[model samples]
Target: MPASDSDAPARAPWWTKAVVYQVYPRSFADSDGDGVGDLGGIRSKLDYLADLGVDAVWLSPVYPSPQHDNGYDISDYQEIEPVFGSLAEFDLLLAEAHERGIKIVMDLVVNHTSDEHAWFQESRSSLTNPKRDWYWWRKPQADGSAPNGWGSAFSGPAWTLDDTTGEYYLHLFAKQQPDLNWENPEVRQAVYSMMNWWLDRGVDGFRMDVINFIAKRVELVDGPAAATGGGSPMGPQIHDFLQEMHREVFEGRRGEHLTVGEMPGVSTDDALLFTDPARHEVDMIFQFEHVGLDQGEHKFDVLPRNLPALKQSLSRWQDGLAATGWNSLYLNNHDQPRLVSRFGNDTTYRYESATLWALVLHLHRGTPYIYQGEEIGMTNVRFDFIHDYRDLESLNHYREAVEDFDLDPGTVLAGVQTMGRDNARTPMQWDASPQAGFTTGTPWLAVNPNSADINVAADLSTERSIFRFYQSLIELRHESEVVALGDFALLEPDHEALYAFTRTLGDETLLVVANASDAPLSGPLPADVSGAELVLANYPADPDAAAHPTETTLRPWEARLYRL
Candidate 1:
């Protein structure tokens, strides 16, 4: 195992102090003229990421797959997909990333595998195959229906019938990806072997997909439907399998490897259990509470809620996890919409609004993660037809809205238009060239229409661009101990327009303030803080802006960071 100095502070553990940049490989860049992103394309972008000051890059899944879930469904763990590159190219990318002081974390989809996977193919060949138990299969009901009434995450019943076997298999997501039977000891051992194999190849760590879903309700009892879609409750026995996974794959034998779990549908208290360092289940976990703030109950309705309520939830999670375990903090990801269009005024004040939103989340208590093109303030695409959508989740939701709910296609498209996974999957805007230079031929997904005006090459040269603001933000956190590991205290919780917080480590203090409203209000700084020095701001205070205290108003969606 690789070793660092034992005396190094735990706060400065390899991952906590490291800034992570998420690269959705398909959209990031294309180098081989294959019209699809490859490992070589990622290698070409290493210098750009390093210059942006991120210490690590977490690439979305690149393993062999049918692209059922945009590579989230894996057919083989040990080899790179033919379209992405060869295994040798993956090794080259890893080496190049390390040369730039950036660690690479592979996405590990352990909860399931692609139906085309060799293991799943073997399991489904017959009712009495050697690997029959490798996946969850249940006997059909007397009525020949699925054993339970659970709903798939994408939509409709969670079970898919295997006519050949005369049984049903569980699929939380698309039917093409079957849930693995983690209860099988052989399955657990196989997962562990894969982990070791990747680590042996010098991959830094793993961003575990649906880590908490590995466990399940062994009884397979029916659950009450959700209030809206009447979906099934989360699987049972999730924690039991998590503990086993920790012992075998994550902790007992691995040395200082980072593992962040996508433990959706977890409560703050439940999240505490999965991330407790002593439990060894994960280094940290990404909570989706903030991401779903504007979402309606089981839907995306665009109904605005009180900002304080959203702030309160974030505060609770931040304070709750501050000392107990770590946090994988982010505002956008490949599975979510772009933050600029969804959360901020992306059209009118793209730069300030986007940077303000970034400051509010990135400078918090957890380790910050930046998604591809987020630094450049990417906005959501406006598609005209249902055929425009590519994500499986969006397609299912649209179908459900039109056929099951009897809703008009326009309204359903509007809902998905405003909030959908495809927003984040658009080909990255690298330059003003055709298709934003994301591909030489046609892109796998359409590029944003505004790409010509919002590409990275343009932002890199502009001093006041959102990309530069993020670059500055990254530098501030890395250079300041208080921002990285100090105790966090959210101040002025009731202030409607002011989002303020302090990070103090002994005598050093850092203050983060965001003007969340179109107009600004002022209050005295936190009672304990004095003589604050302006560090970074989306809109810097001019002499006149700095002179007035109570009257010092901020422009719409302004944000600032200070040191004391």
Candidate 2:
């Protein structure tokens, strides 16, 4: 059991202290020996999630898709993909998860639809089709070039010429995912109808995918020369559309649901507006500032992590949203590499570093999210060859770097190895079985080769395992209001390797310190932490040592929490 702290105030919103666990449906579990996980597999694992103490499960998109960009490219909004299961199975999973006190938050992907969608099919039938204006279509330039210089997020131009229609259409991502024309009132109504349908079917909330890109600039002009053919991250009418969405779908049902928009390039100032309760735009926004700390111009161009810069980014968010808005804290997700592999020492100090990262993220004043397998300290997978990689983004970038730019294939492969989405898409390591206990047949994607050693089964019975540490942290959040609603203050802003901060509420103050690197660190305790109670630590503390020690020594990647 985790320790409880009674000295704090209650937070009104149900999600303030909630911990969300993200489950990428295809990779989570496979119950039917079909090599792919389905709703039944998730239903079978409800007990595990309940025992893990998460408040909700944010499932990645399981809608009917063509699998071009995994499940993000949806062909049908109302039906579940056959590979995942039917609507009946989804209902059963929802019921089972709710029975375990876990809310189900569906992944809402409306930024674009798969080219096979009925609307897109009709839109492309002819230039004069009523549905034609539902998508962006433009005549080619006089020189037979694209309408604009916008680039596709996948690699090439955003505009693709249609031979039959004799015009080009816009697709910000893969050509198969054509962006919807949000300026159309009918489109907005249709989207809201879909959202209301899901909510009526018992989904607790939505984790909207790339929702900010739904509203593009009216003129649809070319972006900067180096811009990744995806147009503006934020457009002039984004807020208007969001506000209208709130009025249409969430006006009277505010507190009954949660809405988090995945805004890739949102800054703190814009986040404040997006999350302001009075505005009703969204409950929260997942900003990318901190996650991009170790990347250069492009995501594949990896850079050394800078602790001070990271601290500044996170601290600014904490301070900026301290009053009006809220935040969603996370390290790993379906789109990013595993946290332990990217931010922590996944080899020599895997357990310690995982625990340290969890402590820092959970102690902050925000709702924390844990990606599947992260609790067990999953590391990035290294596919020996390009043939093993399955993510479209990785494969596209690899082709552009090696074939188009003439970059060294080995160097490009190394970058993909370090920062590919496939690293997080590998099947969950359930046990030391031939398929990591995820399936009886071959997995849709290769299970990480190291699953035999780093798996949930091996860690479940271990008292000091990373899974256990995460469980304790989640329990603490449920029991301690200070962990959820307390004010945040950075303690060592300039510390190169140690991330330390304080959380205070009324008469209660908590200090959290973590050694983010693989070296021992000794430092003088923060000014007011002298007599604080040693509430938690990755490594067991010396019971005989003085509680008010002036200085502290942290072992490699160690973390400690003190309550004053």
Candidate 3:
């Protein structure tokens, strides 16, 4: 039987209440005019982050890498990327961040390693090499083609033939990033050892990348004859691998540390097992279901987002995991487009929509994540030409769609504009200076053209800036126990543009309503908010409205919270 709300476990660890800020290291800040952000750059901005009231900073991968997939293709697990900083700089950043009561969570990309990594290098040396089993390598089929029909996420076949070994290796992502063979005990041990080394250095936790793909199906069969490409995300051994990782790396050090796995194509049931405290797998998992709502089979093929579908998807996860597990709430990240541009209005109603989105996400019974530029209501970039995009996946897909598939270039460009990951990877807009104050040198990627008006420096002093609104939301989560542990109930789930929900803990209940549209909405209270005390709102609502609450008018993208 499904567990009742009363049977739910105790309030989660500190992380459950904590607001995590994800910093894309390469674009967050640049200190040395190197056109790239580094550890010192992040350290320099510690005061800004602390002022924003986030509990932890989740840094995207900064490990040594060839950077084929940014820093996800790690070449050395134990060392910091030279472009980012050295080991000493990392330690300094950690120490300084902790001094200000901020925890640091490193990105752990263990699903694969760069081909330049020593293990992969040795693995490809010869079939008889000692480290041959460190990565997934298979002999070519009789037709001299790939070992399987699996596809690469970046386009084309997932298998890349290694001339030195005369065999094909699996890479679910880019060809340069060869998937690790977690079936081999030594590979798992190496990953754990690297994690331990970082933990011993005072890093608080890890945000594991594509962790679900660690264990692929043993049979390595073809996905579907009609499939474009990409191997199965979930494998039979995923649970075993995660359990082993917990026992070996996180068993005794579980307390005070966060472990969130980024699992693509993961179902709610699989997420429960992965996050169940008794199972000891992970503290939480980042599921892609919500983000993929408007995305077609291919991410570039955009579709209209349905409000009911989104509410149903999120509500199911909230109810499914209420008894034992936790959720990580977010709308934007390194691999996704900016939330305001994708889901909310980014023009005249930018601030209103951004804050409304924040209210909706943070008020949910889960830990909220704020992407680097999200607090300031950053919009997606408008790069006129494809060359302006630096994302490998975006570039490859654009080429595949236009050149191979013979699709219209204009159509492909429009899709790329709407869904490209590069939209979120533009340089951080610190000020209105040249290059948006990111660096004196030319930025690796173009700074958003609108940064002159929409930037941190300009918003810092604005009374109703999106940044200040996000700060208030974070403060609320920290102050209200009900916000942290309340049982969630979706209100008006069928409403096309109104997203309304309530959180109940003991006798205290909080109602949150947002008009997730560009037009004004007026309606009767979705629930009994008769005696609700006005707690928060993105726009100034008449104080008398709360006294006699028969009906309310929500401004464009307006959001409100009331305590009952």
Q: List the residue pairs that clash in candidate 3.
A: 151-229, 151-230
Compared with the true structure, what per-residue lDDT tens digits does model 3 show for residues 292-401?
89988789999997888899899999998887788889999998999998888889898998999999999998899999999999999988999989999989999999
Per-residue alpha-carbon lDDT of candidate 2 for residues 1-564, written as tens digits (9 for 90 to 100): 011233334434778879999999999999899999989999999999999999999999999999999989999999999999999999999998989999999999988999999999999999899999899888877788887778887888888998888999888899999999888888999999999999888999999998998988655444333223344745869999999999988878744588999997778889999998888799988988898989998889999989899888989999998877888999889999999998899999989999999999999988899999999999999998987899999999999999999999998998999999999999999999899999999999999999999999999868778888888999999997778788899988998998999888767888988889888887676655656688889998855336548776778998889897
The segments of candidate 2 whose C-alpha lies over 4 angstroms from its true place after superposition are 1-11, 222-233, 543-548
lDDT of 1 by residue, 1-564 (tens): 001222224436666667899999888888877678778888888888988999888989999999988899999988999999999999899898889888899999989999999999999999899899999898877788777777888888888999788899988889999999887889988998898888889998899898777877654543332112232234556666767766766565545577888888788887787777777667788878877778875655766745776778888887877667677788889988888887778787888889998888877877899999999999999899989889888898998889989988898898888888899989889999999988888888888899999999888878778888888888877876666677778887877777888777767777887777666555554443234578888875646445553245566888877776
Cα shift from native, residue 272, model 3 (Å): 0.7
Candidates' TM-scores?
0.94, 0.96, 0.96
Q: Is candidate 1 or candidate 2 better by TM-score?
A: 2
Model 1 scores a TM of 0.94
lDDT of each: 0.80, 0.88, 0.88
Q: How many collisions per candidate?
A: 3, 1, 2
C-alpha RMSD between model 2 and the true structure? 3.1
lDDT score for candidate 1 against the true structure:
0.80
Clashes of 1: 3
